[model samples]
Target chain A: MKKHRLLTALAVVALIGLLGVFNLTFDSYKLRILNLCGIYIILGLSMNLINGFTGLFSLGHAGFMAVGAYVSALLTMSPELKDTVFYAVPIHPFVKAMSAPFPIALLLGGIAAGIVGGVIAAPILRLKDDYLAIATLGFSEIIRVVATNLQSITNGPLGLKGIDRVVNTGWSWGLAILTVYFIKKLMDGSYGKAILAIREDEIAAEAMGVNLFRHKMYSFIIGAFFAGIGGGLLAHMLGTIDPLMFRFILTFNILLIVVLGGIGSITGTVISACVVTSMMEVLRFLEGKMDFGFFQIQGIPGMRMVVFSALLMIVILWYPRGLMGTKEFNWDYILQRKYLNIFNKKKKKKTVSEEN
Target chain B: MTILNVDNITMQFGGIKAVSDLKMEINEREIVGLIGPNGAGKTTAFNMITGVYKPTLGNVYFNDKNITGIKPHEITKLGIARTFQNIRLFKELSVLDNVLIANHLRLKSGIVASIVKTPNYKKEERHIYEKSLQLLEDVGLLDLINERADNLPYGKQRRLEIARALATEPKLLLLDEPAAGMNPQESLELMEFIREIRDKYEIAILMIEHHMQVIMGVCEKIYVLDYGITIAEGSPENIQNNPKVIEAYLGVD
Candidate 1:
């Protein structure tokens, strides 16, 4: 427990290091991208809990993120924007009367998204494999469609524009750290084992006394909650909102993060999220500038994704166990310095102790 | 009072009757064996008892309470644990985690207690891990505590499965062909292990084993099933000489 707290503290200090140690504008940009990556790490880890660990397929992450985004937006949006955004007086006449600070609004948004995820998961999580994947895809579309059609709230696709810019690099990084820390703690807990067992084998998990429905639902909703938080962070980062932002491709990007990181590995996911997010952001510099001699071709929109998907396919096909293969970054792996030292240490210790 | 009474339990899968009017009584701490040939409805009967399937024509009573069609996990929590014919350990998890998962059935922590990980929850979690480790020790698997379950050998995997089920702290344990794929030596060792577990733990065992030696040597009482029906019920000596049991086994051959 002391180790957990200490790690959390160090993570927070590292998060602050991005802003404190470097004062250059480049540092701000790096921090911004890193902050977004931090959110993605949280999002990716939650999805791993559901799809990777519980062996359930869900594509409704965007839906939960949308819920969090909208809930937080509604709570935090300046009164002037809300007046122009909503066609009807807010459903809660009294709630419409008041607005909160950005942090409170974001927290409320996370809680609301959690509730939404829980309710939806109760029914949608009942499905598995292709059925589950399809159901959750339908759920994401449902959320998207609702956000588009419901002009009374969510600004009906035009989205809440000129929104608050309180979600800077510092807040995003803090949340990312908190999210990963809590997830790691949970994974080490007993409930985490139940979820992992289900993924390894559901029928066996059930017979072993795991409440199959409950664990499946738990993973589904928790993953969704963090994805929702990530959405809130994204909204804050862009300082703008649009319905198109919550599209399937955005969901695909997070999935790519998990795939690159390795399924069921926390540390791997964090590193992958950081690497992928930065690479994508940096690759944006190449957009529409390449001029090939054969056809005068330029970098097209979504080109980076093509490369990313290609990389994802190769990684999955060539190394199905992933970069980390289901192993966590525990003290053993760290002390061993990636297993080399551990192997030698074990051999030396065994032989030396025997001789002694 | 009968702890578990199967009153003419019959199960049907479309046109086939998997188990038909199979009546049995399992009192506390009685090591009973259900022996039969392949597809002899022994697994079907065991499944019905463990609530894997709803019986076609009868009801099962536990502690004088009807538990004819409750969910499998609920039945486990009701003090009945089981092992499968095919070894079904959680392949990705460590052996300790395999046993710790079974402890989930007993954890009374609510969602809030878990997410925040309150003091009470930490205490409960630690206690459960200690208990899980103890169960591993009981099965002589403590040394391979951190090994992935799928990496264990055939015999050890079977033993680990038993240890996982035992972690549920069951009153009645249903073993589905506990000696199915073992060699003669492994099977004999298993027979002794089964007796030792039953006697040492004082837990009732209802095993569905095809090995005659296991039933004859260890089980105090025997039940035989063929074509989804209980054809014979007696002591090992009676089952050995019973013309009906021998004819059933020979006829199938």
Candidate 2:
């Protein structure tokens, strides 16, 4: 166990060093993709915590993300910038003069999303399975509609722009690493077991003294918190976001990341998040015109989604348990095996020598 | 002292009565067996007692406290834990984790402490881990502590359920069909294990079983249920020889 702890610490340090290298080497375009990947990691991990670990099928990521993005963007925008951006309809007086530091704004944004999640969870958590999914989907739609119609606060359909681009690889991936660490720590303890038990068998979990509603709320709220932070990061990274940007398609992308990665596996989510985010960007060309040597082909605008949908289906069919299922990857597992092999070899040599 | 009392409890699902007018009591450190033919509502009676279902009539008392209509988790927290009839182990979790989850009820650390991994929480977590290991050892699953519950053989899975229930430190443990899938020798060992647990832990045990050997071997008293009604209740010897039990098993001539 001591060796395992030391190995884990080393692994974390190595990961941080690798992130530092990526930050130093990547160009702005490449850094943008990396930043997106980091945000997706946060989004994917948070969604997995609710849908995978806690066994609650929620589809409210877009709603929570919207809350976070709007909150953070509104808070960090300067008073002058806010007025100029809401030129069609003057910005809300209360928020016009209000601005906070980047980190504080991100926190408030996450808390705002958590508060919204709690409110929605109160009534919707009672619904089970498909019904819960439908209700959360409806809630996300509601949030989008509100954001679109609330002209004074959200700048209406034109969307908020001229926001500060404070998010880079450091901020995005830094938060992602922090999010993963926090989730891992939580899952390594009794609290994590209680929630996972709910996923295994609700009745047996209840019989063993797991409070269903409380644990569900814990997973949901915490998941929302990280998701909100991810949304805030995305908004600051792009310096522009509208209600349209947080459509169900946004949540669907994160869901794809979660499902393809494996439901309850954090490492799986991290790997798949990186792969899926890059794949999405790479697939963008499929939606544009193709210039052949002789003839040019008109691109299909929605072909990217069609291909992605097909890919998701094929992946699910090929690996139903997902890339990792509920398993986690730890360096200790490999080290443990190596140690066992060495010990067995030593024992075999000792017995051979004794016989000789 | 009476550890559990089901006083005239009845459970109705729609028009059908699952358990009707059921009255049972368990004393400290006593092993009581509830036997019934298929659809005789033995599991239903267990469910009502453990707060899985609200009794349509009458009350359930745990240590003289009225606990009728309480939630299952609340009942468990109030010192009553139960294993399922079909063996409901957390299949994806390790055996150690299965028992660790059951120890959740005993944890006094708040969620913040659990998330933060404070010294108090870490200490409690280590204590729970050690205790879970001890419980698994007592159940003879120490060697497979890290194995996933789903990977265990049928007999070992049943044993895991018992270990998990014991981790909750319940005053009364309810076992439902614990010997269903076990062979004769394994069942014999299970009987001894059950008896040993009752004596060692000082917990009252109420188990529903179809295996007559297990019931007769371990239970000091037995209750026979036929069609949601108790046909006989007495010492195991008396229950075995009772005419009603024979008729309930073999049907009236």
Candidate 3:
């Protein structure tokens, strides 16, 4: 166990060091993609905490992301920038002059989202499964509609521009690694087990002395918080914000990552986030015209989504549990051969038997 | 001392009365049996007492505290724990994890402490792990602690359910159809196991069962119900010989 812990620590440090080196070597475009990968990791892992760990089929992530994005963008933009951006109606007097460092602004954004998440959970948590999903989806739409109409605060449907480009590999990926570390710690504890128990069976969990509503609320709020941070990072990364940017399609994209990675596995979420984000960028080539020597063909604009949709269908049909199921990628799994032989291969048998 | 008092609990689902005016009392370390035909509301009574359903009338008391209308989790924390009739284990969790989850209510650490994993939190977790191991040992499932609850055999699953219930440190334990799918041999073992749990924990146990041999072998007192009403309540022998109980089970000619 001691050796395993040491190895895990070394692996984390090594990963961070490698990312640090990449920060210096990569150009802006490559760096931006890497940062987006980290942001998606945060979003995917947060979504997994609620949908995968607590078994709450929530779809309010886009709304929470909007809250984070708006809060952080509003906080970090200078009063002069805000006035210029909101020239038609003028920015809110209270927030126009407010600005903070990127980290603190991001944190405030997460807190704002968490507050919204908590408030929404009170009413919608009574609904279960698909009903909960629909209610949250409706809530996300409401947020977007509100953001579109609120000209003074959000600059209406025109959106806000001239925001600072403050996101970087260090901050974004640093937060991502921190997110994975802290959430993994939380899940390894008693409170984590309580939520997992709820996912397994709510009634049985309650009967076992787990408070259903409280635990669900905890996961929801925490998930919303990190998702907000991810949104804040994206806003700063892109140097602009808009209501259209946080539509249900955004939630759907992150949901794809969570599901494709295996819902409950953090390691799966991390790996799948990187793969899906990179794949999205790579698929951008399909959006423009294509040349085939003699004949030229016009590329379908939304063909990337078509291909992604097909992939999603195939994944769901072929491997509903996704790449990892509920199994986490940890040192125990990596050193399985050594551990397996010592346990007379019970671990191997267990892994094989429970995969389905 | 009486551990539980169900005083005239009446549960009405719209026009239908599932359990009407049911009253029962269980003292400390006692084993009581509730047997009934299908839809007779034995489980309904259990639900009311465990705070799964709010009684339409009357009160449920745990250790003289009026616990009626409280949430199920609060009732559990107030020292009443229960198992489902259909064996509701945390299927994907390891057997040890299932028991550890039950120990959640007993932790001294709050949400932040648990999330942050403070030194005190680690100590509490170690304590829970040790206690859970002992719990598995008592239930004869120590060897299978690392195995998933869903992977356990039918009998072991039932036992794990009981062990999980016991992890909550309940003053009153409610077992619903514990021997429902068991063979005679397993049923006999369950009877002994139930007795051992009652004696060892010094807890009042109220179980719903259809197995006559298991109920008769284990219960000191038996309550018989039919069509949401109690037919008889007496010592096991008295209940066995009661004509109303016999009619309720075998039907009147």
Candidate 4:
């Protein structure tokens, strides 16, 4: 255990060092994609906590993200910028007066989302499976609609623009690391076991003295908190935001990452977040004009989505349990090759059983 | 010295009465049996006592406190733990984790304290881990602590469920149909196990079982129900001889 802790500490330091190198060496576009990777990791893990760990099929992430993005952007923007953005309708006095540093704005954004999550969870969490999913999806749409109609507060769908570009590689990756560490610690303790128990069997968990409502609320609120942080980072990264950006499609992208990664596996989410974010950039060619020897094809606006859909379909068909299933990347398996031994033993047992 | 008192409780599901006018009292460290044929509302009565179903009439008292219609987790915290008739173990979790989850209700550390890994929370976690290991050892499941709950054989799964309930540190343990699918040999062993736990933990036990031999062997007192009504309640020997009890199990000629 001591060795494992030491190795983990070293790994974290190495990751920070690598991030520093990328920040110094990478160009603007590459740095932007890297920052997106970190933000996606946070979003994916947060969703996993709700849908995967606590076994609540919530689809309200987009709503929480919108809350975070708008709150943080409104707080960090200069008064003159806000005036220009809210030209259609005057900005709310309270909202106009709010101005904080980037980090504080991000924190307030997370807290706001967390509060919203708690309020929504109280009535809807009694629902199970697809019903819960639908309820949360409806809530997300409701949030979007509210944001669109609440003219003074949200600029009436005009969306905020010219926001400060405060989230760089360091800010995004630092928060992502904090999220991963927090979730890991929460799961390693008794609270995590309670949450997993709810996922495995709710009635049994309740009988075992695990309060279902309270634990579900915990996972939901915490998930929303990190999702808010991710949204704040994205808002500052792009220096512009609109209500359209946080539609159902935004939730679907994060859900896609979580599902592709193995819903219950943190290590899987981290790897797939990086993979899917980078792949989105790499596949940009599919959206642009292409010329091959004798033929040229015009750019297709949404062709990349078709390819992603095909990829998701193939993955679902071939690996029904997703990339890592429910297993995490264990240091013991890497250091001691324990997985290989298990595989070999399984094979040997098969042979022995055949002889019998 | 009554540990549990069920005062004329009735469970009415719309028109049908699942359990009606049932009165039961269990003394401290007593081993009691609730026996009836299928659909006789044995499980329903257990549910009412455990707060899964609110009694349509009357009240349930534990340690002289009225505890009717409370939530299941709160009931467990109030020192009454129960295992389901279908053996509802947390199937995906390991045996040790199954027991550890039961200890969660008694854990003093709040979520923030646990996340921050305060020294107090760490100490509580370590203490619970050791206690769970000890409970598993006592139940003879120490060797299978890391094994998934569902991977265990039918008999061991039932035992694990009981072990999980015990981890709640309950003063009254209610077990529903513990010997449901066990063979005669397994049922005999379960009787010994039930008796052992009662004496070891110094807690009152109320169990529902179809196996007469196991019930008669372990229970000093027994309550027989038929069609949501108590037909007979007395000592095991007396219940075995009662014509009404025999009529409930075997139709009268």
Candidate 5:
């Protein structure tokens, strides 16, 4: 156990060193992608807590992100910028005067999203499965519509722009690490076990004294909190935001990462977030003109999506349970070389007779 | 020393009465049997006692406190726990995790404390882990602590379900069909297990079973229900001889 702890400390030090190297060496475009990867990691892990671990099919992450984005953007933007953006409709007096540091704005954004998540969850969580999915989906759309119509606060469809680019690698990765650490701690404890129980069997969980509503609320609210933080980071990074930026497709992208990574595995989420983010950039060539030695083909805008769909199909076909299924990336498996054995041999089953 | 008192509880759905005007009592550490033919509302009565269903009329009291219509988890917090008739174990979880989840109600630490790993939370977590291990040891599941619940044989799965209920530190345990699919020999062993748990845990037990051998072997008091009404309430021997119970089980010729 002591040795394990030592190894873990070393691993963390190595990770810090690697992050420092990437931050120093990477160009602006590469750095932006890396920051986006960190944000998505936060988003994917939070969504997995609700949909994958707690067994709630919540597709309302985009709504929570929009709340965070708007809250943080409004707070951090300069008063002059707000005035210029809200030319047609005057900005809310309270909101126009309010400004905070980037970090404070991010935290406030998370808290606001958490409050909204809790309020909606109180009524919507009473639903189950497909009904819950549809209700949450509807709620997300409602949030978007509200943001669009609330012209005084949100600057309507013109959106918020000229926001300060304050989010650096340190802020994004630091928050991502914190998110992973917090969720890991929660899941490794009794509370997490109770949440998993609710996912496995609600009737049994309730009978066993696991309060279904309370645990579900905890998961949903926490998930929304991190999603809000991710949104805050996104808005500040892009220096612009609008209601259209947080459409259903945004939630779908996070869901895609969670599903591809293995829904319940934190390790899977982190790895897939990085891979998918980079893959999006790498695949951008498909969306631009491709020059071959002999012939050139016209770029098909949105061709990246077709390739991604094909990739998703192939992954689902081969690994129906996702990349890691319900299993986490255990260091022991790698150390013992058991992962290689998994390909060579079928798992042995222990029958009742064998036990006897 | 009555631990559970049911006062004329009735459960009705539209025109049909699933259970009606049912009254029963269980004393401290008593092993009671609820036996009935299919669709006799035995499960519905269990649901009412455990707070899954609110009685249409009348009240359920645990330790003489009126607990009617309270949520199931609150009832559990009030020292009542139950096992489903269909064996609803958290199938993917380890046996130890299944029991630890049951111990979740007894945890004093809030979510923030647990997440932050406060000293109090760690101590409580350690205590629960040890208690879970001991509980598994008592139920003869210590050897299979790491095994997924669904991987257990049918008999062990039932035992795990009961162990999980016991881990709640419940004063009253409502088990729905503990010996549902057990063979005669397994049922005999289950009877011994039921008696042992009642003595060891010092908790009153109310079980619904069709296995007559197991019920008669373990139950000190028996209630017979037919079409949602109590037909007979007496000792096991008396219930065996009661013509109404016999008629309820095997139709009159």
Candidate 6:
């Protein structure tokens, strides 16, 4: 049953990829939107790994993403001296190879993020929910604060620019699919069960022989790795970068996606990321388009966030479980009634023979 | 052969000594009971031996290795597993998944292998699931495999905890207050279940129980403890009649 569900999920993902590829166009704006969706998918999946699967309350995802964005930008740049790859730690030859091209760069960005995540998580992951949230939130702020201050490497507050724009919609969608697939494989595995076990009860999981610290660290690192890769992809799409872009507000935006999408459900995250991404675009038109009696107001970006945060609050109040609430896609969910009949008939035959 | 030796272990909470210099040993395939009044440090001894708490002063030896301060998971991997005093099953997970998670340390695949879905990983994952199912069936919880553990009846929940601990394939099983909430009929049924599992698995059982009916019924030999000290150690009949055991349970005559 597990095998069948996994194969069908893979097939559905491949079909979506084929459809997106066939419908591809030359317009940079549409391409950019698709690419952004992919990045959000990675961010959503990464957040799911930490908060959804591992049950750690982390608000510092943007910190790891910033780390990924900076490092990946440094590695993938064309080696010009102007605020680009200067005094750069000699990235191993293989790392440059892995990240130079569009697709490999996302993976490299994720791995680099994973390394940073491991380091940050080592000291603070041991903390409980609220403490972890504070620690992770502080970590993200520290990354942004330090990035803004250090003029030598990140050009201080101005940020790195002229990064090669290699990330296209195809790469974005492909990596998004890969992220979803990899997360699917994990949440269905023995380790996934172990993590869910930890989430349900930590003391019980330990007595059951699950190494809680190991599982906790694994989930955080993986989550951070993907968050970093997502940031890297986002940087490439923009074709320009600044430390100010990855603020705490950005972290909260991703948090909104994970919470609304249903914490543990990958399918829920993909759909919600697309929906949330488009909501931002539609809300932008409200600034100048709507006329007030006394004042004509252009759509301010901050207004949209106020609305988003309110909606996020409403969703949490309404559905406390956050979408799926530990439910995984099973064969029953995927199978149509006609196909289910096939299995039912076979089971009936076995039962009849046993009675005879 | 001696599978576990609790040598002069003491457990203290602040100023309260829960178990003071308690000593016990269990050979392979033995069924021993730790019984006394409600707060006689019976569970405390089991907790110290299982690495839930570091002994105030003494050591725990399992298979000749000093396992006093090892982490709970390490102790489990070293062939010891336990159930909680108050039925601490992973409540939100399915009954089957609860056992399957317990069996994780036995799986051949590691993190990378599981994520990559290699051929070996598939085979190993299948093996672990099958083994988990078998353990559930042994505990007669196969039908409720898909149900959430917290939804189970009190008696079934206790059985599920035991099945889960068994899934770790421990050489010694420590059950703390297994029959704490059961009535007479249910408690009697649990008595049979405990003995049957011990006989079937060929594993030693060390239990901390307040129920005399279960202690007298299931244990081959028993140890009585009070104020962190062992008061009596003998066969079931001897323990039931001993002055220290009686006084500990009731009061000085």
Off by over 4 Å in 1: A1-15, A22-28, A85-95, A291-295, A338-356
Q: After superposition, how far is residue B90 of candidate 4 from its true place, in Å?
A: 1.2
Could you give the fnat of all candidates in order?
Answer: 0.78, 0.89, 0.91, 0.88, 0.94, 0.92
Model 5 clash pairs are none
The local lDDT score (0 to 100) that residue A255 gets in candidate 3 is: 95
- Candidate 2: which pairs clash? none
lDDT, model 5? 0.92
Question: C-alpha displacement of A280 in model 6, angstroms?
Answer: 1.7
Which stretches of candidate 6 lie above 4 Å from their native place?
A: A1-27, A81-99, A292-301, A329-331, A334-356
As a whole number from 0 to 100, the lDDT of residue A2 in candidate 3 is 96
lDDT of 5 by residue, A137-190 (tens): 999999999999999999888899899898888888889988998999999988
Off by over 4 Å in 4: A291-297, A338-356
| DockQ leader | 5
Which pairs of residues have clashing backbones in candidate 3? none
Model 1 docking tier (incorrect/acceptable/medium/high): medium
TM-score of each: 0.93, 0.94, 0.96, 0.96, 0.95, 0.90
Interface RMSD of each: 1.1, 0.7, 0.8, 0.8, 0.8, 0.9
Q: Give the least accurate 10-residue stretch of model 5 chain A, judged by summed lDDT.
A: A343-352
Q: Which digits, one per residue and each the tens of the lDDT, describe model 4 over residues A1-356?
A: 89999999999999999999999999999999999999999999999999999989999999999999989999998888888888999988898989999999999999999999999999999999999999999999999999999999988678888999988888999999999999999998889999999999998888888999999999999999888888999999999888899899999999999888998989989999999999999999999999997999999998888998998998899877679878887888797777788889999999999999
* Candidate no. 5 TM-score: 0.95
Candidate 3's docking class is high
Could you tell me how far off, in angstroms, the CA of residue B98 lies in candidate 5 after the best superposition? 0.3
Runs with alpha carbons beyond 4 Å of true place in candidate 2: A1-7, A291-296, A336-356
How accurate locally is residue A12 in candidate 2, as Cα lDDT from 0 to 100?
75
Q: Candidate 1 at A333: error in angstroms?
A: 2.4
Q: Write the per-residue lDDT of candidate 1 for residues A186-218, one digit (tens) a residue.
A: 777888888888888887788878888988777
lDDT of 6 by residue, A1-356 (tens): 67896878788778776647744653666567767877898899899889987889999888888878877776677544342343344333443343365556666777878887888899997799999999989988998899787656566666777787888766777788888889988988999989988888898888888998899989988898989888888888787788888888888888888888888778778878988987877676654456778877765656777778788888789987666555655566556775888889999999999999
- In order, what DockQ does each candidate have? 0.75, 0.79, 0.81, 0.80, 0.82, 0.78
